[model samples]
Target: MAALTKDSMFERHIEDVEKDIVSVTSGETRPAAGIDSEVANFFASQSQGPIEIDEATDRRLRWMIHKRVLLVMVVTYFAQTLDKGTINFASIMGIVEDTHLVGQQYSWLTTCVYLAILAWEFPTNRLIQRLPIGKYLSFNIAAWGAVLACTAACKNFTGLIIVRTLLGIFECVCQPAFVFLSTMWYRREEQALVIGAFYSMNGFQQCVGGLIAYGVAQIEGQVLKNWQILFTMLGCITFVWGIFVGFWLPDSPIRATCFSPEDRLLMAERVRKNETGIQNKEFKWYQVREALSDPVVWSVTLISFTNGMPTGGLGAFSNLIIKAFGFTTLQTYLLAIAQGAIIMTFLFSAAYLSKRYNQKLLLAIIYTLPNIIGTVVFLTVPTRSDTKVGLLISFYLTMAFGAVSVLNLAVMSNNVAGRTKQVVASSLVFIAWAVGNAVGPQVFRANDAPRYIKAFIAHMVVYALQVVVLFFLRLYLMRLNVLKRRAAALRESTANGEDRDEHLAHNHAFDDLTDRENPDFRYTY
Candidate 1:
């Protein structure tokens, strides 16, 4: 016989492989490996063995888990926010006056924190996948808390800079670790609310930190200044919380002590259904590539970058902005408490709506709109005018979108599959945030103190960009949803029909079903 052509031989091999895959997928023939048996065996072995769980017991158990986990997440995140927000609190305590730091040097503290975060986020996220996450996270929290306490003892600008740098290094693990932990515990539908509840710590810190700082500043004849006392108190509280979390928090569903064997299995199965599969044990470069290649990842990056700039500005200098309203230091702190309250309300509302209606993108746009308006008002309204205070209040209140940033995180978690991919997605999302944050504080120059016109303008432009980015992201996601639905329908049709499988097998053709095969999968865009 004449020599077979390469194309002809390749086509024959593809036809054979397709026939096998079609047979396996379509139930046209039993797979020689017995997939059902394997699945059953895998579950039986991995679980602690089955036990019946009544609905009431299941509900109670789940509630306990949620309560425990949420407590840890909320406290950890609250501490994280408090530590980061101390700059704002410190500003009022005469930190600038004491340090005599000026201009860009002042900006460097904020910039260095974010720069540290950007450098460490990816590697830390990856480490979380391999290490004992809860334990690692708790240790990190405690370490940062110790550093935060040291902040209260700083004598000059150099001391403050050193503490802030150390604070950033230890604090880097909390954001991504908390996010990954949430993914482990909650289903996709429940994620936004849980994430929101955890993220409400940001607002809660503002409220509580203001109250506490007011009290701490009153200490008489202390060895430390008021700023030092502020750091000490916050740091001690965080350290205590860290100890509690270290001993108490469960690392994963498989390791949870509160859940019975059957409940654990149910939890696993429930998550599997939502995730499209169980979490992967091993990291893979291909999985990272898959996550990085998604358009949604980039869309979220852009949205986060834009939204983060205003959020970062508010975080770094909210107190300073409020001080411009001619409020006394105590008044500024109290007003911050009110602003924190407004932020909490909006954060919870947005989160609830996003989860209830699956409107992640829409909620983002809605939250961004308020901030955009607030920024415009702050930029245009005369600084000496009373209306400027209202505009400033609006600016703080509109920052409810910071909670939506956590919602964006939940979206990314839901969209990416495999531990490696999750790590990559989390890193990129946080790096975008760090970048925006690093740049934001620079806009608030010392010269622009009472009327930060340039800073307000910068915020206005960024918020507008946020709106635009969110719009495009929503469109991209909508398109992806259409494609996914069409693909799912085709898969269903293929499963149900004989001729289609035969054709597919003979033709050696199949639509990309990787998204379906991977349960923890969705289009990032």
Candidate 2:
């Protein structure tokens, strides 16, 4: 049957059950009217299961969404990555010496950014949920762009930290908004690769930013320093792009003015197979309680933390490590291009393997093992002129840490199913991310600078923790899937074999129910 026509039989059936109490995982039902009205309107509004769309239609529709939705996500992520990595680029461009930074002050610059993110993540998530997420991100993009531009004016540690903190507050919205947008615009099967497409921009920016830094560093006889020019140029570009996104990117299927009314309904219908609701405005606190208590959620959260520490240390120190191995300033910038390539390769590979083989947790461990081995080799290799080549190779291998983030989001986005719960759980994971980042730089103390052997040692241990946590997480999800299967079988026998799937259908699909409350929901590893 066609979806969304009011005159149809499905629309009529929807009217009858619009307010009907529905069964939950606990076998209890309550008056629930908390889903997005766009989704709640007309037929197939709440009651129908997946609409069997043809493969051709699916391909065309996905292409349209990629153009309209995923493109915006990609550029926004790319712009943010450039602005965030500018400080690392600037480390060689004279920001530290010009600003009179000494000892641990440089490390604190990196730490303070994540600390600000850790402090503001929850409130930022709340605003993201309550607002038009696309527009909200646009505003933040412009705000952070302006803040990054102001980094050119900082004359001391205090000034740089203040601006960095503001930049963190604004940019913290990027990841959460994109995670929720993956749910809004794509099917469950498509989310992993779609997320990777945007996320790989970090590596893309690494290449692009390195070349830009190299060109800017060659400027001579200029009043504005090379670092100053770098920040101001990227910052202005980001600010302008934010303005463009505000005008261009559509909010959601319900509010997408770019598509025809018929297309909007079709878009909404397309995502219903997720068995997860499209949009929800109401804040349900009990769902927050559930996310906090769930061990599976915590397992993902821990993996994020473990993965974050190594990334922080490496991101902040890797360029310096490269410079320390007898390379010139220009060579360091040039070498970072290879680092970006390594990052892009790992991210693309992880995304592809997970989507093709349906093995996220296993792939996460695979991605991490190289990072562990790389850190070991990095510490063991002599930091001499002769071993610089070996040292660079080891450092590049450590870039695989960037790939783990794809798996974290793939597992988190596919598993969690409620607005507030998603908000809280993702926030917790990033909070762990922030704490680990904050701590990651501290291990690379100035006393240990040059090789920073302690930092490499710390990362080896952190990578091991990540592998252990991810193994248990995989086991936990497997156990849940088994229990769900057994429960379905038991319920089937009790129903006298009356096509038990008929009873287990997604009756609460649009109720804004948490995954735990939706009996039809299954875990995705």
Task: Estimate TM-scores for all models.
Answer: 0.84, 0.91
Clashing pairs in 2: none
Model 2, range 333-446, lDDT digits (tens) per residue?
A: 888998898899999999999989878998999999888888888888888878999888988898898789988888998888888888898899888998998899999989
Candidate 1's clash total is 7
TM-score of 2: 0.91
Residues 408-480 of candidate 1: C-alpha lDDT, one tens digit per residue: 8777766655556667778888899888888888777887787678887887777777778777767655544
What residue runs in model 1 are displaced by over 4 Å at the alpha carbon? 1-42, 46-58, 276-278, 490-525
Task: Identify the runs in model 2 with alpha carbons over 4 angstroms from their true place.
Answer: 1-26, 30-33, 42-50, 490-504
Global lDDT scores for all candidate models: 0.70, 0.82
Specify the poorest-scoring 10-residue window by lDDT in model 1. Answer: 503-512
